[model samples]
Target: MLKKLINIVVFVPLGVLLIILSVANRQTVTLALNPFEPSDSLLSVSAPFFVFLFLAVILGLVLGAAATWFTQAKYRRRARSEASEAVKWHREAEKQRSQAEKLATQASLPAPQG
Candidate 1:
């Protein structure tokens, strides 16, 4: 619940701002680009407004993934190292316990009196 509220608070204003800017700059912003040059044939392929928006979204996703990978790489290495150390310690503990049990058995055996 808290997460949803925070997202709304953060993104709602940003979305509204984008809408406002889009409306204000509609004339200045080119919604489509002609694939053919001015000297080329009359046939021209043009992209729509949504195409630009889609490209922007894809670019943001790529950048976000790159940033996350870079930041978490070190932590992933550290976690693996800690897990290996834990396994080493656990094996040593088991060895020590087995040795202690063997010693206890030896001590309990009847001894020849002098």
Candidate 2:
């Protein structure tokens, strides 16, 4: 239910905005690749303004996500180790519990006479 609401509120608006941008920015513009010579037409490419806008946005998002992942690498490693430690402790506890139950049952039974 929340997902639907989010789609309606966030995604729908964003999609409409992108569509409008694309339509409004349909004009072709030259993009220079080299920094040394900005006027070099041979090293430039022509594309729609919307294409550059979307590409820059996507590139920024990818770089930002990659930086975030790298920054949190230590946290991710710590969480993974903690998870394994928790599992080990849980198994050890279960084993001890079973052993205790077995001993309890044995103590409850009557001894056999020779």
Candidate 3:
């Protein structure tokens, strides 16, 4: 219930704000890829203002996610190894318990009175 309210409060206004911004800045602009030339550029793109703005935002998100994944890789590896080790120990414990129970049953049997 709280999550839905928070989403509505935050996302609705954010969406409306973005729509207003895009509408206000609909003018086309030229983006020059070549750094050396300013007046005349061979590599360039002509797109709406919102296109570049959204592209930068998307790029930032992608780069940040990549960095986070790489940074936490060691932790993920350690957790996987720990999980496998725990499983091995658990199997060994069950085997020992079964062996003890079998020994107890054998000791309870009567010996030959020759």
Candidate 4:
């Protein structure tokens, strides 16, 4: 519920602002040059103004995902190493505690001090 409220609060004004901007600048034209040549002659997507916006959004999403995955890879590796080291330490501690208990029992069995 709170998340939905926050989303509405954040995106509602953003949507309104975009609508206002689109209305105000509805007559403007922007052009982008495609670096790669199309192989098919009939499938040339060269001229529409909205195509640039679409390509920009797609590129942004791909770059964002790549950046997120790249940044998190190191942290994931570190977390795995830390978890394994913690398990190893726990086992070593348990072994040492058991040995200490055995030594204590043996010492209390009335052995003569030399």
TM-score of each: 0.54, 0.82, 0.84, 0.52
How close to the true structure is residue 47 of candidate 1, measured as C-alpha lDDT? 51
The models' CA-based lDDT, in order, is: 0.78, 0.97, 0.93, 0.77
Per-candidate clashes come to 0, 0, 0, 0
What is the descending lDDT order?
2, 3, 1, 4
Candidate 1, number of clashes: 0
| Residue range 7-113, candidate 2, lDDT tens digits | 89998889999999999999999999988998998999999999999999999999999999999999999999999999999999999999999999999999988
1 against 3, candidate with superior lDDT: 3
Query: C-alpha displacement of 83 in model 3, angstroms?
Result: 0.8
- Best-performing candidate as measured by lDDT: 2
By TM-score, the candidates rank as 3, 2, 1, 4
Off by over 4 Å in 1: 8-45, 111-114
> Looking at candidate 4, what is the lDDT of residue 33?
39
Best by TM-score: 3
lDDT of 3 by residue, 46-66 (tens): 889998998998999999999
Question: How many residue-pair clashes does candidate 2 contain?
Answer: 0
Counting only residues 3 or more apart in sequence or on different chains, how many pairs clash (N, Cα, C under 3 Å) in candidate 3? Answer: 0
lDDT score at residue 38, model 4, on the 0-100 scale? 44
- The list of candidate 2 runs beyond 4 A from truth reads 39-42
How far in Å is the alpha carbon of 57 misplaced in model 3? 0.6
> For model 4, which pairs clash?
none
Give the TM-score (vs. native) of candidate 4: 0.52
